[model samples]
Target: MNHARKVHIALNVTDVNRSVEFYRTAFGVEPVKWKPGYAKFDITEPPLNLTLNHQANIEGKGALNHLGIEVSSTAEVLAAKQRLREAGLEVIDEMNVDCCFALQDKIWITDPDGYRWEIFMVKVQDTQPDLTVPQGQHLQACCRQ
Candidate 1:
């Protein structure tokens, strides 16, 4: 929303090769550059500069809560779910879910290295959650992140 045109994320992975494969399926794009212990994906679909680094001892690698790609429509989210499922990856679809003071339609997936990623589009912003379930059944408003 500022002057930034692309978002860059450098990840520490236990195995670059495996992470590359996971990302390839997740983003539906291959790495533009690859080298020993490193791979880079210059993605255009989401305008991301994603890189994978081989970390011999990356303790709490998955501790980095989660990553996400925010799309513009629910249809795009469904399309992503379809594409990800076709790639043999496990996808968790959560539609019309309220979280973080907003409602969204999203899908979740885990990479080979335990990184949780989501593809989501916000539906309603700055509104309180309003589902029936309670206590861990759904994500409550905590303003996380």
Candidate 2:
């Protein structure tokens, strides 16, 4: 896949204009193409080609757990969080969270029509499991797996 320059994602949205605005703020760039019921974004930093398709039925989102952009460092994650907040977008953040044997920092935002997105960075690749917690300690949603 070295020849592939970017990954493409087509999302079904209830309102194209609204979604376009959200993405415009999220990506900090205007769409390369835009029109009624459709918009396209060529995101350079994350190497993503994202599109919005107006759909009457956005309920069946098709096995999509969530969408994410992975960054290189915790500072990058915090920078993304700050940018998102300054844009007046509601952001939920997790810092130094241990999940799947990795310590990660992440910021989450939900787009119009209810799609979740995350900008994240893994601080540590692998971490030893903690033995202090009692058995059956509830797991955070990200750590469920």
Candidate 3:
């Protein structure tokens, strides 16, 4: 038997309305479901489900951790980049970048609440030895203490 499941990601925000507006403008989609203090957007084209909830305090909640959306092709990633830039959101290009021992073409952006989000296409997966530079190469270690 083959089964499929939907992915849902919930993000806490100070204001649901503001977050909704940002997401709507950025993704070019409206939330299919919305209620007081809660909203759900079913991003159709990319098949992502996003939920936003109002919360006064998110500190120490691990809410700032990064999340990513992987697309099928590099062109899609570039399209998203253009859309995001046109919406006046801060879009960063990390094209042909190497991270976690894999090569990817990606864009990184931060939401209103400062959570890092990455939209990327995996160009190739690395199987060779890690090429990451050693600590202190850039005057400090890359990894945190």
lDDT per residue (tens digit) for residues 2-116 in model 1: 2124554657676677787899999999876555555568698778867675556668555243566767788888999999999999999888886544587889888998777
Cα lDDT tens digits for candidate 3, 30-130: 87655555555768666675667555677777543346676777888899999999999989888887643347788888888777777766576542333
lDDT of 2 by residue, 11-86 (tens): 7666667788899999999987565455668798889867676665558565343566767667777888889999
2 or 3: which has the higher lDDT? 2
Q: What is the C-alpha lDDT of each candidate?
A: 0.66, 0.65, 0.63
Pairs that clash in candidate 3: none
Query: What's the distance in Å from true for residue 105, model 3?
Result: 0.4
What are the clash counts of all predictions, listed in order? 0, 0, 0
Candidate 2 deviant stretches above 4 angstroms: 1-61, 128-145
List TM-score per model, in order: 0.49, 0.48, 0.48
TM-score, cand. 3: 0.48
Q: Say which candidate scores most in lDDT.
A: 1
